[model samples]
Target: MQAIHKRLQALTLLIAEDDESTLKWLSRVLSIYFKEVRVAKDAMQALELFKESPSDVIISDIEMPQVDGLHLLQKISQLSPNTIRVVMTAYNTPEYINIAVESNVDFYLKKPIDIDEFLVAISSSVSKGSILSEEIFLNEDYSYSYKQKLVKKGQESIKLTKKEVLLLELLLKNRKSIVSIEQIEHSVWQESVSADAIRMVVAGIRKKLYQGVIENVKGLGYRIE
Candidate 1:
């Protein structure tokens, strides 16, 4: 629990369960470690809260009114591709597993959830949140090392500030996809930031990486090309 607590304390989580007793129990367990835990009675409510305040991890029950877990996961994937999705349900059928996999859920936990396994899954999800890959090529001269979180061109290493590193990582994670200013503020700053502040951060990153590495989609957001 101590180890799990450390790994989850900084993360925000959402749990959707139609059963009141199960919801209360899960919320209590999750609140022990997670920084913020939001609960929803059904998938629709979960989606609403998720849109209002995106969460690092989303744990949802497969069976729910209006929108089921699989449908919710699909919507979430479109809304926030980086969010970790988990499905917890009593149904342990092959069809459910196949559907969950197709929906891109990060984890599937059968009801009567094992505490240890659930903790491990959550920890793994947190680790996966990092945009690290084998390598990401920024340009002909520069490549970003996901493991090192450094940019390199030949033998020279281009230094990046902490904020710059976060910004670059976020962009690379969503490479070629538009990342909204709101998403940038939430993921990088972890709080509300002025649009001007986000622009300044982007400006600083552009200066380091070169102007065209990041493209500003006017009125939309930013993307890495």
Candidate 2:
């Protein structure tokens, strides 16, 4: 555990789990390394805390009351795409694996929590954190780095979901014409989605960037001007 990078201690981490004993154990171990460790007994509380003050990383359990960890991770992905997401689970089923991939999980800490395994998982996340990359200027206000997989407005990062990133990338790729709704679904969602759902995602990107950053074609689709 001491082998873990010192840079990790500079980050804030949040852990969501319903079990009291497990919560305490994780809190005790991680609190030593992280600058701050905030624990939530349920995914809802975790969501609330994240919205209030987004953490650098989050580790959530698969089984919990009302909401599961995968769903929570999805929300986190929407709220802060750059935040490293990890799942804690006992089951290694294909179903869980698929969902975790869709939610953009970075690592998995299996149940029974070996001290070595958990430390390695955190270290992996820290390794994922730092990288030097060139930026592609998207607009006057925002720039994106493909290597870092991030969008930035000057110094502040624009919080966006993975779907939002895909949609933005699609529009930027087709900056000349309106990318039809069908195209958005195929490239971004990869499945059929309602117009309203698409609208919400577009609206979300605009909110993060600027209103005029994304232009709606009214009847067709959208594009970046």
Candidate 3:
């Protein structure tokens, strides 16, 4: 656990679980290595903490009151989806597992935690960084390295959800031009999405960008210029 702790301590982790005992154990384990470990007893609290500041990795329980893991994952995907996520569950339900996969979770572990194995899994996931090629750049404003799967803005690096990165890449590829809504949908999700879907994604991006980072061309697609 010493080596694992060293690697983990280099990161900022967020743990979302309602169980006090489980949270305590996790806190102890992570505290041994992680410099900072943020805890949220419920999904709402997790969301609040996430909005306040994102983490390098997130470990959440699948079952919890207020907001379940699945819903929290969805929100994370919208906000800071690039962070590595691990979902823990006590029951092995096919339906829940399917949802976890769909949510793009890095790992799903059954309860009755094995300290050594869990540490190994965390080490593996942390090394992977953001899941996807970091080589793709999102224009002059943001640069992405597929190898690191990292997104950077000028001197500062910003964390982007996978979906957000995809959208930004598409827009950058079509800079100074109005990318059609359908085109964006096809390129990003490989399927057509409603205006609301696009709008929601745009809103998420805007919130992060926070200062007219993306421009909306009325009745047309969005652009970075």
Candidate 4:
């Protein structure tokens, strides 16, 4: 067994819970272990936070005001497929079970959550994920490593800013289609930014990593292909 508990200290967690008490209690406790624990009082806020900066692992309550956890998890899944998703619900009926399975949820926990069980769920998830390395090659010259979060060209290694990396990843992930300005702002920039600001980032990446690779779609968005 790996030292999964030790890995918690380096990972970031996002918890979406409606109940005020549960949210507060969860934030207070989980903060002790995980390097960063972000709490959202509702699923909408959770979605926004997730868009701003996706968490390594997400824990969401099933029931919410406007949107439920299942829906949120579905959106999160589309946004970041690598993210580990867990749902908590008081009602563990066949309906929810089937929906959870359909949503590709890694684990389902009942309400009145046990901290130990939560930890075990997280540990089990880590154990199941690929231990092998992952690399994304941008071109014959440049390649990126998911583990190192860095791109390399020839013998020199280049590091990217958080926004730069997010922008690069977003564009590369959706290489088939245009990444709309709205999507880029939501995923790459934490807050709203002007088109010029976005262009600057793109220009920087082009100058540094892959020149003339990223394409612009007028009045639409950016794309790699």
Candidate 5:
């Protein structure tokens, strides 16, 4: 359980469910594993929140007011294809299943939700979602091999230092949201470090890569666009 919790701790999740009791209960349970959890009563509200700030993983009910989960998932897929989408519902109708499949939902859980299965599904989604792509092209010249931790620009290839690689990995993993300084320090340094130190490290990475590759959120932290 501890290992599972740690694995999920980095993810931010959005849950859309119209049932008040179910929403509250699910949110409370999921909050234990995930770093942040946002809840919406309907698909429209979920879509609005997603547009405002996208989540790494989305777990939505199949039926909701205004728009259904399939429609919401479709819009979200178009907006941010990398997001891990999950659908849950009591209805096991063929039409609902077909729609969910067409929406490309990562997981479909039956409602009267099994806690163990739900956790496993979410954990798997978070782990997979962390890697947005096999390779990330920083620009026309520079590209990063996420699996190899190698940076390439044409024929020249440079291997990132352990710290730089870790930093970049962290940024990419939480690409959808601003990773706070505290979180960065804990993840990268594994201890208390000065904010100035963090800034210096980021600056060095920018120098090695390119300017504007990483965006600083003022006092918050950093994010890779």
Candidate 6:
């Protein structure tokens, strides 16, 4: 049971619903528990918000004017797999059921959502994994020794710093793609992360890991090999 903090608060929730009334009502209800709530009038808005900064959980309706819930689910999976996703649909079709299963959504509910069920699902999801203890690894043909906290390249052992170790674990979880600097700082330091700080730490890790251990995109973030 984590209290409502910036890191664990219902801190931010992304809700995609087209109906004005329902959206307002949901925002009101969720605001009571969460410190910040962002509402998307349609799927496109939801996707944009998600891309900007992923939410702790996503609750979206199936039907929308722009993209639709199913497409949103697919995008979320491809872009941000760590987000806990839930879909709400009035149409209970076999197709949707299959999609939900394939998408591996946290839960699916009919329209006119039951708040209690939603709360239960969310609570269980939060407790399922220890966010602090996750490991993020690269897809290289390298062997990792976690207990030893070493990575072997040929006959050499690469020693990582405390920050490097934490950063590496987070990057491994987000393998093959850019991990947002925001996520890295918040999760690792439990404080605000500055670009200068991230650069210093990343440079240190790269120097130890390999010549080109981490790839830094201009506008994006870090990706490890």
The whole-model lDDT of each prediction reads 0.82, 0.78, 0.73, 0.82, 0.80, 0.72
Tens-digit lDDT string for candidate 6 (8-126): 45345788999999999988987776657899998888887776655667888888986888789888766656677889988788898898888768789988998767866776665
Distance from true position, residue 23, model 6, in Å?
Answer: 0.6
lDDT of 6: 0.72
Which candidate number maximizes lDDT? 1
Per-residue lDDT of candidate 4, residues 67-137 (tens digit): 99999999987776667899999998999999999998888999898888888778766566511125666
Winner on lDDT between 4 and 5 is 4
Candidate 6 regions off by >4 Å?
1-10, 130-201, 204-225
Candidate 2 minimal-lDDT segment of 10 residues: 125-134
Q: Evaluate model 2: give its lDDT.
A: 0.78
In candidate 1, the residue pairs with backbone N, CA or C atoms under 3 Å apart (3 or more residues apart, or in different chains) clash, namely none
Candidate 5 residue lDDT tens string, 135-223: 77777588888668878888888777787887887777666577777667766787779988888888888888888878999987788
> Candidate 1: lDDT of 187?
67
Candidate 6 Cα deviation (angstroms), residue 206: 6.7
**Candidate 2 global TM-score:** 0.57
Cα error, residue 151 of model 4, in Å, equals: 3.2
Per-residue lDDT of 123 in model 5: 70
Compared with the true structure, what per-residue lDDT tens digits does model 3 show for residues 103-164? 88878888966767767887776566442232544555766654354467778867778778
Ranking by lDDT: 1, 4, 5, 2, 3, 6
Estimate, for each residue in 93-150, the C-alpha lDDT of model 2 and write its tens digit: 8888888888788877678767667667767755664211235577877987654666
Any runs in candidate 1 off by more than 4 Å, and if so which?
Answer: 128-176, 180-214, 217-220
* Candidate 3: worst-modelled 10 consecutive residues by lDDT: 129-138
What CA RMSD would candidate 2 show?
9.8
lDDT of 1 at 175: 74
After aligning candidate 5 to the native by TM-score, how far in Å is the CA of 214 from where it should be?
A: 10
Model 3 stretches with alpha carbons more than 4 Å out: 131-225
TM-score per model over all chains: 0.68, 0.57, 0.58, 0.73, 0.62, 0.62
